[model samples]
Target: MSLPTWELIRAAGLTSYFLLFVSVSSGLLFSIKAAKPKTNQLLQVAHQSAGWFSLLFGLFHGLLLYIDTYKPYSLVEIFIPFTTKDEPLLNGLGTISLFIMVLLFISGDLMKKVGAKVWKKIHRLALPMVILISTHGIMLGTDSSNGWAIVLYASSLAIILSLLIVKLLLIKAKTKKVISA
Candidate 1:
């Protein structure tokens, strides 16, 4: 059976959110000094790949809305944050997240030109991007109340939060070791 247009939009939005989770989690591993070199490389690849996928899927979801007979969105609203008259705040959060993703993607290559420290700071936006994306989904997604969607969102949030805690602990331990040494 053929799927409805809204169903396609829902699937793309959910997939994009899932990809965003993968991208952010993989990016966090790069911050751990103790992470194995080989493992870090793999994580970098995953982060890059997932970031691209998430952006693409997000774009697809927004583009699908252009043809949505129920509620059409203009390009300005879809691409620009805070411009959508309908659910402006929620859509703005998502638009901001997309811009963050684009920056991170470009900064990966620009690291050489911009210097590693600058690039790293830019990439750190991933955490905030996650917040923006999650809030956008929760506030705007129609399928967000579904049992599966709730579980997915909760699981992703728990995992990312745990990873953040781990990164913080790792940083603290390294700091203490340095001071004691």
Candidate 2:
């Protein structure tokens, strides 16, 4: 039996979210010097691949909404923020987050051409992107109430936040050391 469109949409969304979590985690590991050189190389590959997959799945999730029989979304509603009558605010958050993710992905690929300084500035947006994406999913996702979904969201948040804290502390320590030197 064929899976329903709504189920497909939900699956795509969840898969995209998980891929995004992987990409961010890999990036954080590199930033915090948590991996050995050889392992870091593998992480770099995973980070880039996961990022592309996340964007593709995210786009697919949005597109699937168009094909949904119940409360179908228009192209405008899918791409444009706050254009829909139903749950405009929550959906708009998702649309905005997705756009930010796209920007991050494109800029990441062009990091060398853009220069490390500029690329790092753009990369900082990842934190806010994660926040917005998580909020959008937890607030709007149909499966969010399920036990597995709840665990996924909670654990993802906890791990990401913990890594971010470590990154910040390491940066502060380095800055202090440079000043003392």
Candidate 3:
């Protein structure tokens, strides 16, 4: 069963985005491991690996689009945010998300060079990157009208939003406790 080039592009992009989600999930798992100090070092490694996979698959997706005869993407369109002639806003989100992911990639090394607080502050961009990519896929993807794609987007959003909300609440509570004491 041979698939068309367009289909391959969709598959590559969707799979890459999924890896990005997995990377984010693994990062959360690593963070929560503080509650269970016995957690394996593998968790952190998995997070790093997933990020690498996401980058690889994302490059694959971009390359496929660049080579597509139907509507070829220039290198600038591929790398620069909001520079694409086609689907400027939609594809722009993907570019912005890519920038964020790259920042996250180097954040571990930066954690030592910069203080942990600064590094962590930069890392928080992951949340916005997730939302941006999901928006990009939904708005620009061929599967935008597909029920499964919508569900995937919704479910991913729910998980990430919930986690962010919980973290925000915990931070607020901690701040309040400190102020009162």
Q: Which numbered prediction scores highest in TM-score against the true structure?
A: 2
Query: Candidate 3, residues 71-173: lDDT per residue as tens digits?
Result: 7798889988789888888888887887787788788767788888988898888887888888899889989799998887888777767766666777798
Model 2 residue 22 distance off true place after TM-score fit, in angstroms: 0.6
**Highest-lDDT candidate:** 2
Q: Which regions of candidate 2 are displaced past 4 Å?
A: 1-3
Worst 10 contiguous positions by lDDT, candidate 1 = 26-35
Report the C-alpha lDDT of model 1 over 28-138, residue by residue, as the tens digit: 776664578998999988988998999899889888887776777888888877998888999889888878878987888787898999998997888888888889998
Range of the 10 consecutive residues with the lowest summed lDDT in candidate 3? 31-40
Model 1 scores a TM of 0.91
Residue-level lDDT tens digits of model 2 in 1-181 = 5448898898999999999999999889877877889999988888889988998999999998998977789999999999988999889988887898888877877988998898888888888988988988999999999999999999998999999899999999999999999
* Deviation from native of the Cα of residue 32 in model 1, angstroms: 2.8
Estimated TM-score for each candidate = 0.91, 0.95, 0.85
Residue 131 miss distance in model 3 (angstroms): 1.6
Model 3 ranges with Cα > 4 A deviation: 1-3, 33-35, 40-42, 179-181
Q: List the residue pairs that clash in candidate 2.
A: none
